[model samples]
Target: MTRHPVLEARNLRLQFGGVTAADDASLSIAAGERVAIIGPNGAGKTTFVNICTGYLKPQSGSVRFEGREITGVTPREIVRNGIGRSFQLPQLFLDTTVLDNLLLALAAREGIWNTWTPLKRHPRRDEMLDLLEVIGLTETAHQLPRELPEGMRKLVDIAMALALRPRLIFMNEPTSGVSTREKFAIMDVVIRALQHNATTAVFVEHDMEVVSRYADRVAVWSFGRIGLEGTPAEVLNDPDVRRGVVGS
Candidate 1:
């Protein structure tokens, strides 16, 4: 028997004025696979992620999740179809406590947006607390985003995405904006949480170390298309990737 890919894009094309963001882009991600998208800046990695996750409408092509076409769907519809994504910047409520931020996410997942309701009494409060613990932010749950370090903020964003109980999650530069000393630590926590939930992940990352350590497969984008797709060793060590992507 054949298992279908969790997400698949075929012959995607997108453009902005004179710039072609995606050109004949195609890929498939199986369930539970950790796929990394890496490329030089402006190579359209983020654009492709946006298109796949329904944040951008491609000029042409199709996207399928679990064998059903989802191209041109709304972002919220995609989320409802079991896709979640975190941005390069932490998309958090800066004024709210970490716990409140997650509680809000849980509420959004449940289609409850009554902001007047007491979050502490929400039916899913315990689930939100468990997510905080999973992200290693239990002790700082009451702290505002401003009080938390960059790494913790990133984790909280990821937690909010996870609260949706997505089958596949896209993380755009999860390690960006954090100190080098904290990158691995942040990744460790994020990866552990993903594993605990048995979620499939696709991440856009610039750090070769992060890709090497965490990716099950890698796709390198160049000239608005996938130039290489293989294991970390195959993609990272390719002469073209070193020169074109790594700039070595």
Candidate 2:
């Protein structure tokens, strides 16, 4: 049986007045693939993710998830159709405990009306706890976001995104703003969690080492378009990518 790409964006063009945020850019990611998008700052990596996830609309072209056009769909609707994303900065409820944060995401995922129901009493609370264990954050579930370390907070944001049960998840700079020592450990947890859920991942990454370690394939975004696409060995080793994108 033939299977369509899990997500495909073709010939996308979005202009921001004089600057082109996405200039005739396109990409297709297969199911179960870990694709790392590499580029310098301002290279339109996030623009592609925003377009696909319905946070930003493109002036021209199409975004298809499972062969259905999702261009201009609301972000929530996109998520419903099996897509999710995490931002560069950890987006967490600083006032709430880690467990509650995921419970909220689970409520949102299942659309639970909980005005009268306590979150801990939700039927899916066990699932949330299991998720916490999967990400190795079970011990910290009672801690508030402000009380957790930055890396744990990042994992919580990722766990919330996973609560959506998306077939595909876009992670913006998954390793950015963390210490070098923590990057690999964080990525290990994330990739393991994704594999556990059978989810595909597309991450915008500036760290070449992280990309090389985690990505099955690499896409080099330059000047609002994809400059190269191939295995990490192929794309990461190219002269241009090494010089301009990798800055090594």
Candidate 3:
């Protein structure tokens, strides 16, 4: 049985002045699959994500989610349609506690425009706590973002994204700023949480170790296009990828 793709982008083209960010990019992501997008510094991996997530409108292309065309939709609209994403930097309310941050995200997900409203009767406390537990941050739920370490901060951001209960999530460099030793720890918790929720994931990653361990499939971007798509081993060992992406 063939499963339909949860997200699909075809013939995506985007440009920023003279630089071509995405050129004829196309990809399909199946439900519950973990995909890693990898390439060198300016290969357009993040640009493609921005386009799909509605942050950047492509000059030309079509984006479909769950069999519906979503190109040119607003970010909030796309998120409401079951797509969510976490940024490379942890996007959180630094002044508030981790728990409160998740609460706000939940409120926003429900279209509660008054974020300042009292959360005493927010009605989603248990759900937020479950998300904290999934990210292994239940102990620090009461702490503010600044008080938490880098890795935990990242987890909190992810937890907030999960608060929306998105069917598909895009993670931009989830392990970027954390120390090497803590990278796997963060990814372990993240992958486990995704599986627990049965959510599909697409992440832009530079760490080959992380990609080999976590990614079920890999997409290699080069000069604004996906030049290679295959298993981690296949993409990692390819001579072209080795030279262009890995800088070997």
Candidate 4:
């Protein structure tokens, strides 16, 4: 039997002012796979994500989710299509409580806005709270984003993405700006939590330790294209991957 890819990008190309952000990049991730996209800065890692999540349109290429081509779909529509994404910098409602941030995400997914006031009695509130616990932020659920540490803030942002009940998620630099000491701790909790939820994850990360720990597969991007793809050990240990793409 042929296994269908849950996420697939084919010959993707994107350019901004003569700078190619994504150039003919292509890769496929099966359902339940945890893949890491890694490279140094300007590797077009984030740009690849932007195109995948519909935040940026490629000049030419195709993005397919579960057999359906979704090229050029709007971000909102992309979320509706069962793919969620998190930004590099934790994007959160700074003044909103952790619970409120998730609640807003739920409401947005359901497309129910009062226009004059917040809706009460969302059936998914309890579900959202459960997600908070999974992300290890249940104790601070009532606190505002500003009151939480950087790691917790990232958790909240991920929880918001999970609130949408996506089948696959694209996370951009999940550990960026976190204290070095907290990096592994945060990742352990996040990966374990997502596994418990049966969520498929793809993240762009710089930390090789974190990537080695969490990624089932690794894709190395360089010069705005995919340079290597294999298991973590396979890809990371490849001399070409090390000296040419990652080390460059």
Candidate 5:
């Protein structure tokens, strides 16, 4: 028996004025797969992810999750339907402690806003703490996002997305603003957390090494389309990809 893909996008097309963001774009992601979308800037990688997560609506085509259409759903509807995403830039309440950041995420997941309860006293405090521990951010739990380094801030943003308990998560540029030495370590923590939660990952990445080390497969986005999809070695080593994407 053939299992339906967990997420499917079919011939998605989107445009902004004269710029084409997605042009006949389509892809399918299976459960448990770590898929990487790699390309140069403005190649439609982030645009596709935005469409899937409902942050941007496509001009045409459809996005389906678990065999149900969700192209026209709102972002919150997509989240409730088990899809979540983190942005290229870290999005967090910089004034709040990391723990409170996650506590708020947990509350949002349950649609429990407007509570006067303190974060420390939230019902899911322990669960948020465990999530922090899983992502190697336990020690920074009490630190504000402004106090932590960029890498830690990225992880906190991702953890907040995870708190929503998504079946599939899209991470846009998961390793964009970090020291070279810390990129691998950051990805190690993020990937392990995704695995622990049994979530499928689809990340947009510019770093070929990150894609090589972490992705089960890769899709090369070029000029608003995926020109190739293969294993890391296969995609990264292709002559066209090396010339077009890697610019080598």
Candidate 6:
């Protein structure tokens, strides 16, 4: 039997007026692979993720997941189809408890009417709790997002995405805005949780430490396209990658 790539992008291009955010970018990840996309500040990393997650429509190219061509799917459709994403900045209803947030994501994953109706104690709730435990936030499940530390809040956002039971996840700067001490810890929890469940993770990160430690492969984007794709050690040490980060 032939196994298919969990996600794939073919000649993806995202342009804004005369500016090209991402141009002719192509990549693939197999099931359970933990890959990192690394580049300098304006390397179009997030633009690639936005197009993949359906938040932005690319001017050209195609995105396919699990053999289905979903070039211009809506974010709702993408999530429903088993692709979930976490924002660079944690996007949470600040007043809501962590439990409620997870429940909301679960409800959304289950569909529309289910979200409005009172959430019943179900198997999914147990699953959410298990995820909370993994992210080290189970003890704070009743706390509101504002009460948690930045790292924990990031974890909560990730947990919310995990509740959707996605096959692939796109994370934009997963460790961005986090302190150096907590950055690696945050990535550890997120990577471990996803890999434990056989989910493919594609994250855009500026921290080479996290990339070296967690990424099974690294793709360096430069000049609106991919400069190199290989094992972390291979890509990171490449002269082109070094020049891209310093020169771009």
Residue-wise C-alpha lDDT for candidate 4, range 128-222, written one tens digit per residue: 77888777788998898999888888878888888888889998888989998888888887787678767799999988878888999999998
**Residue clash pairs of candidate 5:** none
Q: How well is each residue in 1-248 modelled by candidate 3, as lDDT tens digits?
A: 76789999999999899999999999999998999999999999999999999999999989999999999899999999999899998999999899999988888887787656587468777888888988889899899899988889888888888889899999999999899999999999999999988999999999989999999999999899999999999999999988877778
Candidate 6 or 2, higher lDDT: 2
For each candidate in turn, the TM-score is 0.96, 0.97, 0.96, 0.93, 0.96, 0.93
What C-alpha lDDT, on a 0 to 100 scale, does residue 129 get in candidate 4? Answer: 79
Q: Which lDDT tens digits does candidate 2 get at residues 30-144?
A: 9999999999888999999999999999999999999899998999899999998998989898998999999999999888765888888988799999999998999999999
CA shift of 135, model 6, Å: 0.8
Cα lDDT tens digits, model 6, 1-248, are 54468888999988888888988999888887888998877778888898999989888889999989888899989988899999989999887789989988887777647534576464468878888888888899898999988788888888888888899998878787789999988888887789667788999888888888998899998767888889998987878777766342
RMSD of 6: 2.2
Candidate 4 Cα deviation (angstroms), residue 49? 0.2
Q: What is the lDDT of residue 221 in candidate 4?
A: 90
lDDT of 1 by residue, 39-108 (tens): 9999999999999889999999999998889999999999999999998989999988999999888988
- Give one digit per residue, the lDDT tens place, for model 5 in 87-119: 899999988899999988998886676568766
Per-model tally of clashing residue pairs:
0, 0, 0, 0, 0, 0
What's the C-alpha lDDT at position 129 in model 6? 83
- Candidate 2 achieves a global lDDT of 0.92
Overall local distance difference test of candidate 6: 0.85
Candidate 6 error regions (>4 Å): 1-3, 115-117, 120-123, 246-248
* Candidate 3 segments whose C-alpha is farther than 4 A from its true place: 113-117
Model 1, position 119: C-alpha lDDT score: 73
Candidate 6 weakest ten by summed lDDT: 114-123
Candidate 1 vs 6: which has more lDDT: 1
Model 6, residue pairs in steric clash: none
